[model samples]
Structure formats: structure tokens, C-alpha cells
Target: MREAFDHMYISCWEWSISVLEEVGATKPLYPPTMLRFTKRDTNSATPGPYSYPAMTLDECQLADFSEFETFDNYCYAMFTFYQLIQQTSGLSGEVNLEVRSPRFLETVASKDDIFLIEGMHCVKFKNDRFEEKVMAHWRREMPVRTFRRKDRA
Candidate 1:
């Protein structure tokens, strides 16, 4: 599973690079402008490490997903490529993709402490299973006076 995760991450990076090249966009010095990693504790930590890939808005449309058939083919190609890489690498983990704001830095200091931007969704792949979840946290702000009732005094 770890191998799959790593392969997915690497593939994502390569794909991003390819997209930039195809679109004639200036590639950043770093493949990923921002990176976030889950936290670990000494007391209960796993032996292997985990990571994922993230891309900016400018990077997303480079593939020209405007062509549905071509885009679908691209996705299949990515899936097959990663599967082969995982088989050869002997790493066992999952591949997960999440749509997030390019300004992720302003909200999330790290993967474990993510603050979801208004319009992002998380897609996760684990143990050959895929799932999608909304990243937004829904909450209502309460009036301050409600907590400080006059009768309480």
C-alpha cells in the first residue's frame, strides 16, 4: 500500500510536469509548490511514512480536460501506470487525491491540521477502494450574548 501511495505521488508530480510542458507554462522550481504531511507521535507511530500530491488552479486545466474522452483516457493511463509501478516497487499503501485551494498555506499548517477552504473536496483511495468526501466543515456561529445570559449574574 505504501508503494502504491508513493507511486501515485510520483505519478502526480510527473503528470503535473507533463501538463506544464504541454501548456507551455513555466514550471516551478519545485514540482509541488506546497506540501503537507500527516503528524506522528512517538508513542503510536507506524513504521512507514505517508504522503500525497496537490496541485494549484493554474496546473489543473493544463491537461485540457475540456476533451472528455481524452481526459478519461489520461486518467486510465495514470491508473495503469501507477498499478504497474506499485507491482514492481513492492510498496503497499493507497492513493488518495484531494481538491484544495492553492492558498492552502493560509489555512493548513500541516496535513494533520487542515483547515478546509470553502470549495474543496477530498478523494481517497485505500486498499483498492475509492471514496469522496466534502472538505468543508459546517458550523453556525452563535451570538456571544447567548452564552452570557443576563439572568446568570
Candidate 2:
């Protein structure tokens, strides 16, 4: 029920007037900048203990999480880490809906190269070399036009 509530979007949130008393009793606490969490538990070994701050793309890049070429895969890796945390603590009572590399960079499909997946086959290729090959193949068939200013022409 807690997880379901976290995932759901509600138009209304119930707040009690106890906020007035709490605020009067304590120092002013600033509002949180982010709500989503990608927590890690050091005790778990499946997801390990290392992580890049995943709240933003800049944070991920700064943390050198370059192994993930796409955002979806990066998040999948984070989720896996937290899952291991729950599993180790015996807190996982919900069904897991994802299957991915244990660590953020352990993608079973491709790591540092481009891959083409067809049916059950995974074909890996050199991305830069492939681009060059395609360009060379079509270079002669296609013509390039140089644009010049009217005055120069």
C-alpha cells in the first residue's frame, strides 16, 4: 500500500493543523528539493555499495555513470541496487517487475559498444566505424551542394 501510494498521483493531500504547532516549536526547516529516493544499503552484496547521485542527468555524468547510454537503463541499475538492499534486509514483500544488470554498468546486452538486437540474437558493432562505412557507401550516390552568398556567387 505504501509503494502503491508512492507511485500514484493524487490531486489532494491531507494535511493536519498540527503543522502550526510543530513549526512553532522547532527551527525553520527548508523544504526538500527532491522527493524521489534511490537509497542504498551497504549490507547488501547483489547491488553492491557504490552509486552515482541519480537525481539529475548532470549528477549522473559528474559521477561518471557513462556506462549507461540511456536514462532508462541508468534508473534500472539504481532500482536494482535498492532491490538488493531490501532483499538483504528481508523487506521485499512486493513482486519485482524488472530484470537488468546488477550494478549500473552491468548491462547484459551491451557495455561500451553499439548493439543491434534481432529476435534472440545480439549483434555488436563498432559505432564510429559503422557510421563511416555507411557514409562511404552512400557518398558517391549522393551529391553535396556548397552554399555561397549571392555576392560571392
Candidate 3:
């Protein structure tokens, strides 16, 4: 359980970095960016321990969270973090960098708002021209792969 939470945070952090870069941000709107892995037990009174030291933007780089490269995956990761926080103690139940950064605000109408879904809290953002631009940027930035066909012998 602790391992899963750690994975979720790390995944979200990496995703945040990618989104920020895509939006052309020099740094997270918030400082002392919380980029690290933490694990918490199920116990309500216990505090989670940080596995890695907090990293600065220059020192932090994306990890292989490719499986969560899609927006759906990103939302799911956030939802998972929300759930984990509600289930544990000494864990922060707050909005993450990806959802609150000013860079994202340029592309969306709002980001700091939260809504309840099926009794769980989640972040919401309105789509705008920025979404289209981001898609275009991704299309240009991502590498295309091809496979060679073998000739019949």
C-alpha cells in the first residue's frame, strides 16, 4: 500500500514536470516544489517518511511514467493520490502542482477548483485553445516509430 502511494506521487510529479515544460513555464508557480517519494502506513496517527530528498527544478527530471502519459492516466493518478490521502494520516490532502500551476491557467479557464465525484474529491479544468495547442505541440514533439516489413523468400 505504501509502495503504491509512493508510485502515485512520483508519477504525478513527473507528469507535472512534463506539463509545465509543454506550457513553457520557467518554474512551478509555487516554490520549494515538493518533488520526492513518500510512504505512509495505514495507521491514522502515524506520519509518512520521505524516501528521497526534495528536488529543485534543475535537479529534477522526468522518470519513466510513460504508462501514464495520457490525460486520463494523469487524472487517475491524481484521484489515486486523493484517495490515498483520505485513507491515511500525516499525508497531505491538497491540490498537486499539475493542477494548480499558473502555466496551466494560461491554457485553461480555471484549475484550483475541486469537485466531488461519487463522494471523492477531484480537480476540474475548462478546456480552451490551449488544449489544441498542447496537442499540436505533442504531435510535433513525440517521435514516430516504424517497423520494416520483411520480403517473402
Top-scoring candidate (lDDT):
3
Best by TM-score: 1
lDDT of 2: 0.29
Better of 1 and 3 by TM-score: 1
Candidate 3 residue pairs that clash: none
Give a tens-digit lDDT track for model 2, residues 1-153.
Answer: 011112112111101111111222111221233223434443642231122221332332355333333333333332333334344334432222233222323344345332233223223233465344433433443342111222322
Ranked by lDDT, top first? 3, 1, 2
What residue pairs clash in candidate 1, if any at all?
1-92, 1-93, 2-92, 2-93, 3-91, 3-92
- Give, for candidate 3, the lowest lDDT window spanning 10 residues: 144-153
lDDT of all predictions: 0.32, 0.29, 0.34
Q: What TM-score would you give candidate 1 relative to the actual structure?
A: 0.25
Q: What TM-score does candidate 2 get on C-alpha atoms?
A: 0.18
Instruction: Give the TM-score of each candidate.
Output: 0.25, 0.18, 0.23
